[model samples]
Target chain A: MKANEVPQDKSSLDSINQKELCYATDESGNYITTKSSGWTPKTIALNNAIEDIKERAEEAKQRVLNNETSPIEYYMELNRMDVTILAGYVGIWPFRVKRHFNPKRFKKLSDKLLQKYADAFNISLKQLKQGDLNED
Target chain B: MKIDFKHHQSAHCENGVVSNLMKHNGLNISEPMIFGIGSGLIYCYIPFLKVNHGPAVTYRVMPGLIFKRFAKRIGVTFKREKFKSVAKAKQRLDENLKNNNPVGLQVGIYHLLYLPDHYRFHFNAHNIVVYGKEGNNYLVSDPVIETVATLDEKQMEKARFAKGPFAPNGQIYYPISFPKESDIPYKEAIVKGIKQTCRDMLAPIPIVGVKGIRMVAKLIKKWPKKKGIKVANHYLGQIVRMQEEIGTGGGGFRYIFAAFLQESSAILNNEKLMELSKEMTVIGDLWRDFALEASRLYKNRKATTGSYDKVSEMLFELADKEEVFFKTLKKAIK
Candidate 1:
């Protein structure tokens, strides 16, 4: 990792024009800070993580459409959360959160509780209630 | 009101925040010096703990400890507060700003609107400095960014109280009292930092320090055979991101530590530390090479079990290098 050897792979991070500061060695093997657009390895890793999250969100949306679970499931996955994390955000117990994942339970959820879920996912009441994954 | 804070960009968030805040308080400590004095580098692979839906792998010490440890080592103390309510948190923050005080805050990155989407995630251990306020927005110095940024009240509140796994809980800290800068024991602190890091890396534990590196290498070896290729690749991605991603300065803080060592060598007038610094940089390079190979495997779906094995072999080498590196480091300082 020479100072000039710092990679500029132009990944998603670079798309925002924010270069991350990285430490590399100079010709004398002395350390120096160089701003890098991004590294190819990090970009690939991040892209794969994003792809997996999107895939999971799609699966959750399909399950909601089929009435296997509620729209909260779809939104939770969309927000990159699992049951435990979503529960933490909504300030609900994990057991109760899992119960809300059931379509029947979600349908009976009070507006107050539904609002909490909606807020945690940063979506509107209508969006959470409709539970539609299609881009609108 | 603004506190006249100077922001110096660094590879990592906590070190940058701590260093910048110290500078604001009239101390000129480099980011690597802060990282080194804090003993912020470590390798811990917790199998049971899951973050990002994969086994938790920490490349640094737990969040918030670096500042705490750094302050303690330098014989200074920070006024630390965490509020349960967002309103109280905002009030305290504004009070500090009104007094022309810049404070470092532990915040969640997910809801920080100023961050790029690619870097924003559910991580709650991110640190930033709030230096001033103007009308509706607060002036922020996120050291990873090249320039200053801003966050309105609503966005600031959300980031401060972001829940789930190491929640920030509206934590804010600022130095209240300090010895004269000359009395700040750099020599003793440097020795202690080096000794503690050596102790940590050489600890005879299964899942921490050098042994932790070995444990992860072994797990990587068995991952493809035990789990499917997809899951194993996901796990590998977790490790790589933790290492090379933003804030690490690449090589899981190894380069930063090496830089620290290089600086420490000049400070302590120890030729042995200078040689060790070079060795640490070489170890950091090995870690980067490992990441490059592993990332390529997951990037292309054509990766075979043999490829995972090769990556695992790379990890084994890293573990060996780190083992010898820490041992020699321990003796060098002694």
Candidate 2:
């Protein structure tokens, strides 16, 4: 099935969108208060995509942990893929400093980038050096 | 005490050792803080040229045992600025020597880092010594050997240490102004470079994924509990500050990682993991634009903390996406 074609729960996705900010709920996600009975094709579809990315990232990360590739190279590859997805968010709106720099989302992006590197390298940010050795 | 060697123009003598010739003269030598750490070179000044002697002057190349190649790069030139305005240095030299009563000529000591061959780095000391002056043409001492080992006798012999009361090449006339306590300008430059380089490496950026998540988990767990949140907070600040200072996106992250790895867990704590990761993500998203903005601004105006509002927006987006994606997992666990 195509990515967007996959079914998802419209109400669940909408519930999150309605919130001013995603992390605003802190420990509880928006749907946490809802009953667990709300399983739908749309929900499943979104979960699958999320799972796919997670799995792909995991496999790639394992290769790095196993010493197959460098962290920088891997991140670049992810950026290449994500850039297409991110283009709309970045390029769709009128050009403005505020629109361009979404501090909350930027933090997530930064964390994701670092997470990719650290995962692939099997290291903490603290442990990584300019040339940390990894086994392939 | 000025020893000038006349060699063919084509013959390359070690300037590292040649710098010592200034010491043969009455000038006091001060240790070079920067150049002394690795292989060192001797820089010398010649007052006159001898027709029979090969070159007008020569330089001594003192290579450190570990970094021999660096020792070979030291070269000699006629630049007068290399000498602390002789009259000024002389006055200080005279006063210091009067109290210390050095054995011989006073020379300036310098520390230099050089790369002679591929993949090899070296550090050594450079000093100024005088040789001889004849009719406006002073026969200055020159570096005869290419590289020397260490201050020890065995290494000294390998570098062809000549027999003399002076330390290997020449004796310290007056206590060379060692950089130990004085506010020497060159020392400050070297220290700045070293500190900056290290600081740049230790800042943070973001990485994503399960393995990354797992690693962070491991890190958080392993992080020492004794230290307050300050340790983690320091790394977080380092990441942000370095991005601001280096203006090269997230250049400081590697150094931060290096420090984290190098230091004992007793110093780092769990709070650092969450704080650092959060900060890293925020900075990474904005790094490219931020760096560009910083580049456009005057060096003085480029505040490190530029546009936190934008960073805040990015963080919220990330939180939303993560919440959307991870809610299921958290719910299932709940």
Candidate 3:
């Protein structure tokens, strides 16, 4: 909480192109604005969250390769979504979506259903079927 | 059609947008001051209300209220609208920009391109300013980001219409007229802001204010036995996320409140407020410690259930300190 504790070295703060500015009091109790140094404890906590999501995405991707689930499942994981959320976006029942997680069932989905999934994930049907995970 | 708007990054969205908008309208005010005057601090934990499949725990008031309250207190007239159609919303925003008026918008964070992937969630109360339009992109000033950024028009429309809890229905606001800076009453506004904050912190509601902190402490203490370690840890993780990750300006909003207190001290020439500000900073540090301890328990799988008890005890102590702090603050201003 001391001013010195806030890393004065600009390079440490620039690890990421963090645009958010934090307003905190200095050692002399003067308020000043500064960018996050990425080394801050809060930043570390945020990094942990990002890492957890990435790990989930990776696990979901491996499941797709093994044919244990459909590509929709992988996209759901990549978007930090659960069946309830994905179903909400696609306007379907969670139970029905669970059935569609099977690759066979997903392949048989109507264009309407597939289009809904693609729209919810913000991707094209081609990309959805092919398991494209790249950011748009 | 770029309006001459200066964007400054802020610790939180609503306060940042309000501060920037006020500055653009020729009224200069610090973000913390705006936050305080608007009575933005809050503590609410609802077990039934689920956000992203967890109990809803919020550290501040609902979005857009701060802008409303600050404007009211400062005697600034402003216009607010929420369009039923996205196309209509886009047209209005474009017209405002064409006329050189910077407009404030409330959009979901999930679709914002400038945010880091990790930070984007389904949170729909994020605030930003659309100051101009350049071809297919809208030049935006999002307070959480370091600099002004641009968003594709189609993407901005989608973000505006994002569905979920607190979905912004293409909401936009802008100041129409502001009172002269010299005519504003700083001391009176600061006093009123302080009193309202004290009331919010000390209110007797079990699910909000100081009592809400106690309720969370109680839940943390019993979570492992009732919900099991996995569920308890998940809930604790959510708490840390609300406190540290969701643009809380650190320690929930305690740090920002402390900064407000420091400014109040200088304006009122009260050394006691300065002392209280430092004390509040210490309290903020304790909250940070609580977050660190909770996160440590979450990361370590081998951690025993007793670790949950330790964190709960810390919360109880924090609640006690804050209770006394607010009580003293209420009397100090009188």
TM-score of each: 0.98, 0.15, 0.88
Residue lDDT tens for model 2, B178-226: 3322333433332232233222222132222222222322332222243
lDDT of 3 by residue, A24-135 (tens): 6776777777655443444454555556667777887888888888888888877767677678778778899899889888888998899999998888999987776664
The RMSD (Cα, Å) of candidate 1 is 1.2
When sorted by lDDT, best at the front, the candidate numbers are 1, 3, 2
What is the Å distance of residue B313 in model 3 from its true position? 1.1
lDDT per model, in order?
0.86, 0.27, 0.80
Candidate whose lDDT is highest: 1
Question: Candidate 2, after superposition: displacement of residue B284 in Å?
Answer: 5.2
Please give the lDDT score at residue B280 for candidate 2. 32
How many pairs of residues collide in each model?
A: 0, 117, 2
DockQ, structure candidate 2: 0.01
What lDDT is reached at residue B216 by model 1?
89
- lDDT string for model 3 (B1-334, tens) is 7888898888898999889998888788999899888888887788776654456788888888777877888788889999987789989998999999999999988998777766677888999999998889899998877778899988899788876667798999999987788888788888888898889889989988789999999999888899888667667777787787645633748888888899889999998898998898899889888987887887764668889999999999988999999999999999
Query: What lDDT tens digits, residue by residue, belong to model 2 across residues A1-136?
Result: 1112212323332432321100111132110111111113223322333343445555655655565544443332232223222222223222331232332332334554444445433356533333233322
State candidate 1's TM-score. Answer: 0.98
Report per-prediction Cα RMSD to one decimal.
1.2, 29.5, 3.2
Against the native complex, each candidate's DockQ, computed on alpha carbons, is 0.73, 0.01, 0.35
